[model samples]
Target: MSHAQHAVPRRHSGDTVVVLALGLAAMVVSMMQTLVVPVLGIIQSDLEVTTANVSWVTTATLLSAAVFTPLLGRFGDQHGKKPTLVGVLLVMIAGSVLAATTTSLTWLIVGRVMQGAATAIFPLALSVLREEIKPEKLHGAMALVSGTLAFGSGLALVGAGLLTQGSDPDYHRVFWLAVALAVMALAGVLFAVPASRTKTGGRTDWLGAFTLAMLLVLLLLPISQGHEWGWTSGRTLGAFVGAIVMAVVWVITESRVKEPMVDMRMFAHRPVLFTNLAGLLLGFAMFTQFIGVSYLVQMPEDVAGYGFGASVLAASVVYLLPTTLVSLVGAQFGGVLVRRLGARVTLAAGACFGVLGFTWLSAAHDATASVIGAGMVIGLAISFGYASMPALIVASVPAHQTGIANGINSISRSVGSAVASAVITSLLASKTIPLPDGMPALPQESQFTLSFTIAGAAFVLVVAVALVGLKAAHAPRTPVLRKVTQSGTPQSAEVEADAELV
Candidate 1:
């Protein structure tokens, strides 16, 4: 038998079940990450801390998630998938328990950091699904997983708001609930996931992993905290310099290593290179839509904002419709879009949708109608964009590197989200404008207006990249020349032609 046939057969049912469960778990965990946003002010008052310090509750989780996701992806690929997943779930449960029991903000932030490690669940789950699912079903399966990530955040926001708004405002209950979910998810993953039959060999590239970690820190740190740290301060400059040096060192070290942590050579392919670059832009652009819209929906009315004071539940319900509806629509139609227009066309269409959505948002005044309408438009646009981008990444990478490649793609999203937050946060904090005597605070409205407008502009840029640069990006397969050794007349010619086709 050939080597390919001799290889172990896929466990399709078990793999699909594990992926479905992981997708659900990832969705819940993602929602849990942001559940505290609506109640930050209340939590601050009770904990007797400044808003600045309270913000750490959110930032800590994001930072940790971004830093560790790629690490987990690499480890999962090197060792085995199920063990890594179990470890990640255990870490999340520990974090939830710590956060639930702690009254101190310090401990809460610490727990959040630990919980952030679970960020790997989404990418890891995708890697596993890609490995085992039939090629025919892969597209829909990935779409489902991606949609869950987007939709879960919206649901969590609403759920957190509802739980925290009750009498006595139980913020701690949110964390406890997350813990319960994690425990159940752990049990499901352990019981349902099949153990790997593939050989688990080779020592992990510790030095390369460390260097890449430093590289990510260098790249993400300055972008995330530059505004708060003073853009021109030593901290920002040092991070920039450190990122440059580490990146260069990383290149040299990875090149020399027998087993590189990340195979940088993957970028040698034009399709892989440009697809990731576009992914980065899409991330930078689409993430801002959520931030701008969420802020608009929650901001009080006197500030020229929607004044929704819409409890978290109400706002989330509104926010979710766009994502959930579009996701379902996208999953159903993604294959048709791919078959008809190709991945490049689909991405461009998504970006166009984002551009129009953001432009419409920019024109809307701070009203419930505007916020909900904008959410619908932006969510639908992102649905097509998110679902297609990962499929393209999978198509471009080899099976063995699936985990690492997708992990990097996930990192692009994280980086983009951080950039959006930094920009929006600065705009909200620093900008000021005069207001009419009876009108709302001009500064607040102006910030939202400008930020949304800029976000629209960012989406337009993404469209430009998709159209101009990504139009022709596809994998380049080498052509192997073959000759027919037979000395027959027409028969020799036919044999040579057939060999070339192979």
Candidate 2:
């Protein structure tokens, strides 16, 4: 009945292949986000750079991803998803090669910036799934893809540990592994994904894109660096002020643009607004487990009075890996829940699990069994939260707007993570037990308690946001248009749809 409906092909046998290919691509790109965490110290030593300079290997990638992801998503919507996806994979491969081959920190940072463009792959892949998969199967496929992202992050840490083992401990090997995976992903996407027929034909919104980039840079730069550069320092404060100013200008620019990069009005839509908020809170809760548990297991028992002093490899394999593996299971369960209940309820349940998990960790983390149990619970929460987000967003927006909408949602999650990293670091560093004259200080046990409590509170807030804000928002609607496009006018469709897919 509508141009979009006619343009969308019926589900075919190849759809499964497409999902697998795109999921692999999403996993590989997600892996790039955390691959360097276990090896940052080694990279600093090898590159002959200060701790501050070496941190840029991760920081640059963060800033770059924040800048590029939304722009690329918008571009994919305007042009074609398959080509854009393939191009992103190619850039990622090149970046991996450059990082693997180079010894210079500057060159490696450059390579990481290139790799950051791959952040768009997840949202673009979702858009493709919407176009290709049967509606019945879409939720499960998206859940699998989303779960793999969390799985790949943990897998990367384990993979990094294995690759960097032995006295030689070659850090370059990590990037080489990334190169191999990217090549595989590139081939899979090129071969399996069909060319996209749906295109939102519009001129690229360069001004809107630039303003948004500046706003994100201003917001993220301080969040990532505030711990290193004193929080009260001029640079950090100036960046915050600049971000506020830039955000205002961005709002004005977006309102005026005929083809805006992100639709400003979407922020007012109850489902979109609250979904983004819940994403931010869940993102914070997720990172608390990631950074908190990793540091907790590694604390020296004699010095800190509460840890196993685990190595990176042991932490990955023993403590964090099991939880990550469980998350895959949780993701599948979440898909079933979304079909049976709805995204809002699924999200609320996940948030409740988060609150429970973190509360348990905060109270009883003395034994390995307790830590593992809490980790698994949080893992389940993370999987369910991640799975429900895309479903909520995809169900809320039109098919054509899926890419950009999810892109903004992704940015919200990133912002939360950046804040979580900064806040948790600040909290842990706030009060430390003094050691012998030459020994470095260790965080007091109470700091970890405070951190977990704060994270649990954030999850509690998510539960409230979902129940009150999202539930009261407008109901979901089908994307069918009332009338087909005529001449140059755009087709109009009801914004409400049947929310139940199960």
Candidate 3:
């Protein structure tokens, strides 16, 4: 509620326009996470690179986001959101252009690394919502924007499938689409979103940023590559141990710093902490739904002993689109729910939905309707879960801590995604369908059931985190609720006195 927490100025643009601009930017960021999923094979073949080298296309993005999101998010809090957002968007555009034109694996990976930084846009957009939107309408706006993360991720799969459908699949088309999205997002932000009116001006915590970046790199590197590197191997185990050591060092460094990049108290605050735990579980469930369902449907029924014999396009459009649509629609309602029911109830509800959806998926994925319906239900869970994030964050921390607090939350989810990706890959590979000589083996049908079961378990833990850890927290402080002054600013009382939730 402090004056320093300005997202964008309301006087410069309508709330709708500003929200849309941030949402578009966030959507583009989400797309970067999954843009190359369907095109990796083509990218490998066309570039004549080894499978291991081509895989870096995705890993580079994963590691890059882990390193840069927190750094740039804190940078925005210190410098100004407009410049930070503009810088990140420009990087995305340049990266997209590089990726679109690249014929070399090294450059393609470099491009992906640049694109990954756009993930910082989500936290920045949320912080902007905190400063600019009134509390009365803020939860809804945050929910709508947060929902884009899920919708955009799903959209990438469908789009990638269509763009790469024909025999001569042009990998460049995928990056070109990214360029278009980044351009539109950049335009929306530049034209509609106003500059920040307030900033938490301070010295950059370079040491803390470095330590945190190193921690994330140590953690995510293994999760993303553990499948390729044996789980028991020295490199994988050593990275995990190193992450633990770096985490302790990062904490000590932050504690002693003059201007700590992240506030340890805020990082460990119950509501913020548990909300991030919920975020991790949601991330796991989401990837589980996407990777598990996609891989399941694509299995050749006759040869694989179980599956729909679905093509990749059919998998994306028929099975997954319903989920994406629900994430959009459910989010609007989720915003309303967060306002009426509180973040605790909203998150627990989302977890309940996740349990239901995953149970259905595990028990009855024999028919197409069952697959699509289960996914849609899970999408509702994602919508509600995402909607709860800003509410919890805003309520828990001061306005000055908005960007860094949310940045860490974003990192938590990224970590969850990395773990889920590694777990799923290892699980599916653990038990494969037997095959004739020279033919590749498909995953055993039981692996899908097991994956869904494990995902449901993650959600169950989210329910506990929401109900217990977030039992009571403060409400978000807003500016004066009564009157707008002539200068388009609100005449306000003390921010702490106006706290809403309790």
Candidate with the greatest lDDT versus the true structure:
2
Off by over 4 Å in 2: 1-8, 476-498
TM-scores vs. true structure, each candidate: 0.87, 0.95, 0.94
User: Residue-wise lDDT of candidate 2 within 93-193, one digit each (tens)?
Assistant: 99999999999998999999999888899999998887777677778888888898889889999999999999999999999999999999999998999
* Residue 14 in candidate 1, Cα distance off native in Å: 5.3
Question: What TM value does model 3 have?
Answer: 0.94
The CA lDDT at 430 in model 3 is 97
Q: Candidate 1 — what's its lDDT? A: 0.69
TM-score of 1: 0.87
List the candidate 3 regions with Cα displacement exceeding 4 Å: 1-13, 475-502
Candidate 1 off by > 4 Å: 1-7, 14-16, 197-200, 303-313, 319-321, 433-444, 477-502
TM-score: model 2 vs. ground truth: 0.95
Task: State the lDDT of candidate 1 residue by residue for 458-493, as single tens digits.
Answer: 777777766776654552422211111221112232
The C-alpha RMSD of each candidate to the native structure, in angstroms, is: 6.2, 2.6, 3.7
Candidate 2 least-lDDT 10 residues: 489-498
